[model samples]
Target: MTGDAAAVAAERVAGVAGELAARVTAYDALRDHRAVFAYTYFRLTSDLAAGLRTNNPPFRAPEWVADLSVSLAAAYFAAMDAIDTWLGPVPDARPGGEVLSADLPETVPEPWRDVYAASTVRHSYVLEEVLFSMMAHMSYDLPLALRALAARGDVHHRIADFHRMNSLLASSVDVVQAEIATRYCRRLRSLDRLFVRDDELFTSYGIRVARGLAWFNCDRLLDPDASAEALGSISRSTAAFIAEFRSPDDWRRRRAFQVLRALVPSRRQWPAPAAPVAVGSSPG
Candidate 1:
């Protein structure tokens, strides 16, 4: 894509990010745990859009990164649409600004289904919800998004840009974590020190590991000789990882999560969902 085209794509991504931010604000107002991931994603996309607009963009191939970002975001929104279809609409949450689509997917991806399903259970930990959402998006959707870009004949040379996103993501972690704490769980900020591994799990080490695995999966998907069985195996492994994290069977991790759960406010303690707000309005 030309420079002009890249600028347009970046603007489009900004608009989508704006819409997502609006939704996240609404969800946060409702004390919905789903907001954990939505808010994080909104920040990442918003940052990417801003980076692309800068004179000295961090990425080597801004256009390709913009396209990949959009494709990956589409997967998340598709999952949200599916969740909305399954559980009815979130109270007072409506799409505003640049919306992706009015149509919902016929079937949600299994990994996403698992994430959303875990989200609905009242007992689920805030940290787990965040991690589960990230796992689903990064581990499952990212490779597919990369594969789509490869199919378009643009991704082969953009691997460096893809890797560059890790730094951008790392920069956003502190900001995202702070926002989540202020909006959802006030205890989250300090809890990380209490549970150091949990902190690294979502904010740093785990993300790099997941992204590395995603690129590997993308390479596999791009292989001309790759088989359906191989793809299925990848999907199963991703799903299994999500499941294991969702409810850690190991005594130590489970016990740690249990302690973490007690440290944060329970779902019932949250204020009830507020009345619908006007589109484009900021959360109070």
Candidate 2:
């Protein structure tokens, strides 16, 4: 995309972001993060559909990027709902009438805010946005959330809850992809088949990697001196990576073999249907 076209796309993306933020404030359903995620995805779905009809996507990238966003937004929405449904509500870190125990409004942890804010400015690739989002959410937001809420005594339960949410996201991969294919990628549906394998790696394996990063940061957040430094370091690293990480190849080979060889499943099979595991269950 040329400078002019990119600017136009960025403007559209910013509008989408702004519209979503405004909806969160206005709509009661979007008052919480999880529900807000659902609203964001719902609106994004509508915008993406409009873009598809007009042939003017905000990112000007492939439909896969939009599909990826759809899947991610769905996962986030589902995870939040699943765990929060079972555990009840978590306090908004943002300032309101409720007094927060922390000094700040539990804003998006360092690099997360940076990465997400710069989604339009940083890179052209849709996957890059995904990468930056993963780092921020897993490394910064999740840990801060743990620290800001989850009582010390219930830390284990919260961690389990996090895993449960992550698992819910992982399980919903197919459903999200199908929705994207139906709604966002109708024209590109046939070509999208070639990328089907890639989406699985991107979503399911991606969540596993994200969970690992979250665990890494969660441990740091549990410690006083390390939490801030660790988050800052992650922010710095993500900043550097986003600025420097690029190539003409569009990360194809990278995606083909995204996961490590050791982590590959042994003739894998999906788990059977089970109840939404309760997040507030007392750790045995």
Candidate 3:
């Protein structure tokens, strides 16, 4: 892509990120736990937009990275919209009628369904919600975004830019964590001090590993010989990964409990879900 094209794409990314930031602020006002991941994502997207606008962008192919970022963001928003629709009251139903099951629509990706369900559960911690959102986005949405980009043109040359995204993601962690601490979970600040260096290290490492797997899966997706089967396998693996995170026997859950125990007095408190805003109601 030409420099001008890259600039256009970067602007689009910035626009999307700005819209997401607005949504995060609104979610925060509602004391919605979804803001945990939404805020983190907004920071990451904001950073990417900034990087793309830099005179000497870190990405070798700025346009490709910008496009992929926008695509991924679109996927996230689509899934969230689907969740809202799925969870909303059934249209024109009689009073006290049986509502639809909690299952998301078939159009909603499986991994995201799990994340939405987990986020709504009472007493779930911030870190678990964050991790589940990350897993769903990275494991399920990313490969599909990559494949879409690949279908348009060769993405082999853009591999470096894809890997470079990890650094961009890492740089935003401290700021994201601090903001989440201030806005959503006060205990996150205390938890950060308890783990300190290990907290960031583990978070960054897990992101790198997940993104690396995403790229590997992208390769599998692009393979002409197995693309059909690869798609099914990717979906299955993503579902299983999320299920493991939801499992009681999972080490991550056990560790989260230990962290919860260590910070006994500072248990995470979630606010009640806000009443739905009336249509045409302007945000205060």
Off by over 4 Å in 2: 1-113, 116-118, 121-127, 181-201, 240-284
| Cα lDDT tens digits for candidate 2, 130-215 | 44545555555555555544343445534443454455445554454454333323432354343334433347677666666766
Q: How close is candidate 2 to the true structure, as a TM-score?
A: 0.43
Give the lDDT of residue 171 in candidate 3: 61
TM-score of each candidate?
0.78, 0.43, 0.77
The backbone clash count of each candidate, in order, is 0, 0, 0
* Candidate 3, superposed: residue stretches over 4 Å from native: 1-6, 89-102, 189-202, 246-284
Tens-place lDDT per residue, model 3, 54-142, is: 62355667777778988898999998777656655443431222222245677778777667666655445676667777877887799
What lDDT does each candidate get?
0.66, 0.42, 0.68
> Model 1 over residues 195-230: C-alpha lDDT tens digits?
445445476556777888888888887776774654
Cα lDDT, model 3, residue 110? 74
- Judging by TM-score against the true structure, name the best candidate: 1
* Residue clash pairs of candidate 2: none
lDDT value, residue 68 of candidate 1: 81
Q: What TM-score does structure 3 among the candidates reach?
A: 0.77
How does model 1 score by TM-score?
Answer: 0.78
